[model samples]
Target: MSARLYVGLMSGTSMDGIDCALARCDERGTTLLATYEHPIPPATKQRIVEISRPGDNEIERMGALDRELGHLFAKATLSLLSKEQVPSTEICAIGSHGQTIRHHPPSSHQPSEQGFTLQIGDPNTIAQSTGITTVADFRRRDIAVGGEGAPLAPAFHAAAFAKAGHTRAIVNIGGIANVSLLHSEGQVLGFDTGPGNTLLDHWINRQLGQAYDKDGQWSAAGSIRPDLLARLLEHDYLSQSGPRSTGKEVFNLAWLDECLADLSSPATPQEVQSTLAEFSAESIARGIAQCEVPVSEVYVCGGGARNSDLMRRLAAKLGTATLETTASLGIEPEWVEAAAFAWLAWRSMAQLAGNIPAVTGAQEEVILGGIYPGARPRTQ
Candidate 1:
């Protein structure tokens, strides 16, 4: 079959914005066409965060936000199409990861109860609004088959980064950090490493009222509080086995407070921020070591890649010969995850299996996502 164009839309745990990327994909490989980032309005972001945790009217509020975000996602898709002058009809489908509010895979929770994961942003709405086929809800089947239903990016990473002679690790530092280990032998391994920018971003924003510690400059100005770092590292999650996954449920600000309360000196705001940065770097390095793979190089992506201090710390801790962004490999760092979704959508359309059984612990390979149709032909 000929290559098809697809749009992948992702709103990661950071809750910053929607990322849309246009990809031309076929069985051989996928190529990037154009990409765009659409920031979520403050009101929308506030509503989503508020509804993330349960309350009296949470379900109702969540339903409303789901549709709202779906529309926002559609707006992003349409805007990207307009900017690139690519007709919506020319795209095969849109693969939307949606905004994950809660992701408790069956393996992590009790089997008697529904092993549920919720991503708010209706694919149906995205289809209707954009007049393009949309494929989403990409996590359920893996859960049904006893998988962790996450770290799905590894399948996509393998497609893009795997080479016959080089082993590469793709680390995505979004709200959570996950690593996709690409082996020279064509095997892929991946899992959530631990807290990425989520905790650090939250603590810094709470203390300084800024969105994030820009390029980690604030953290670089301060020193890592060793005592606090030691205490935070004691969490068993750092030592947990792979094929594992985690979310805000485990590493939120509340969890941070428990560690902070045990500290001797009340760390200064900058000190705490610096410690958080150290914590992220420490946890990631530990996770990489646990992989038992001969990691020669590390390619960082997601928001944290911009944090110079975090990158420096990771480099020092891992002792890898070279460290750089996915851009170093010719793929834009910001668009990696977005491109993954587009590739996943293309896989779903082709009825091809997209999830790696080894990474997600699924019983077998499975085609991922539900489809939403577009109004016109998806090619020029």
Candidate 2:
């Protein structure tokens, strides 16, 4: 059977850029076809960061940014197809993960009868601009049915990487870190580990005006501040022992400033950067350790896999189970999330369920994402 083509667009919490991936999806599995990276305009990124936190006129700011992002995502999809010399008509659909602004899952600490998670990048605009069906708004349905509605990637990860007789942990360190514990016995477990690159990226931008620390060199150069690391590690979220999810709403610059407020001595920029890396590494390691099955090997993905210093720290914290990029398993670290979204789009189009209840703590598995049909071809 000929494989169907699909496009996946993802703009993670880092707010760096949009990742557009082309994949050939079928019953056998999904195969990545082509990929493109479109930088998010600095102004647009700043606007997104601003509205992520509590602010006045949120409706206005968010409404505008959503349409802006939709145009960008459409441009990214068209750009990818043009570069590959392919026609948009050939693509089955576009899976747009959109930009997540706030995600508040129902929990004992913060109970909500009407829990909601919002991601915006107008799928209508995407469909109109690209003339291709778009699948988006993927998380809220799971949330509506009494689930975390975040960390939806684990279900895709489990499907892509699990192998019989071996247990593997897929750790994706985006703005926030999450791990998929894949067991040979077909049990899949996952949750957010807290604070990946968001703190590091914010600190560097504040102190050095750089988007992010290159290879985590600045962080590696400084010594870890024991007190700061301990305090950050003690965050209440880290102590929780069940399904969880978080985003910029809970781990932004404001949260970091609050953590530093009680410190006896203010830490230098470099020290704080180092502590952030250590904190992320420790939180990831701790999450992996808590899995019901011992992971014999841990595969890293997302932008974090490219940070050498962070990888070194992760290795030191893991201490034995091989730590390597997802490339070892035939998937490049950077493209895994985008590819997963492509697969999700395939699932959506096939009318198959996408969310995994075991991973998201949902009452049942459900098909995620709302579909917007492509426009009809022009007549002669």
Best by lDDT: 2
Residue-wise C-alpha lDDT for candidate 2, range 343-367, written one tens digit per residue:
9999999998888887777898889
What CA RMSD would candidate 1 show? 2.1
Please provide the root mean square deviation of candidate 2 (C-alpha atoms, Å): 1.8
- Full-model lDDT for every candidate: 0.87, 0.88
Show where candidate 2 strays beyond 4 Å: 1-3, 377-380
Per-residue lDDT of 303 in model 2: 92
Q: What is the lDDT of residue 310 in candidate 2?
A: 94
Q: Note the residue pairs that clash in candidate 2.
A: none
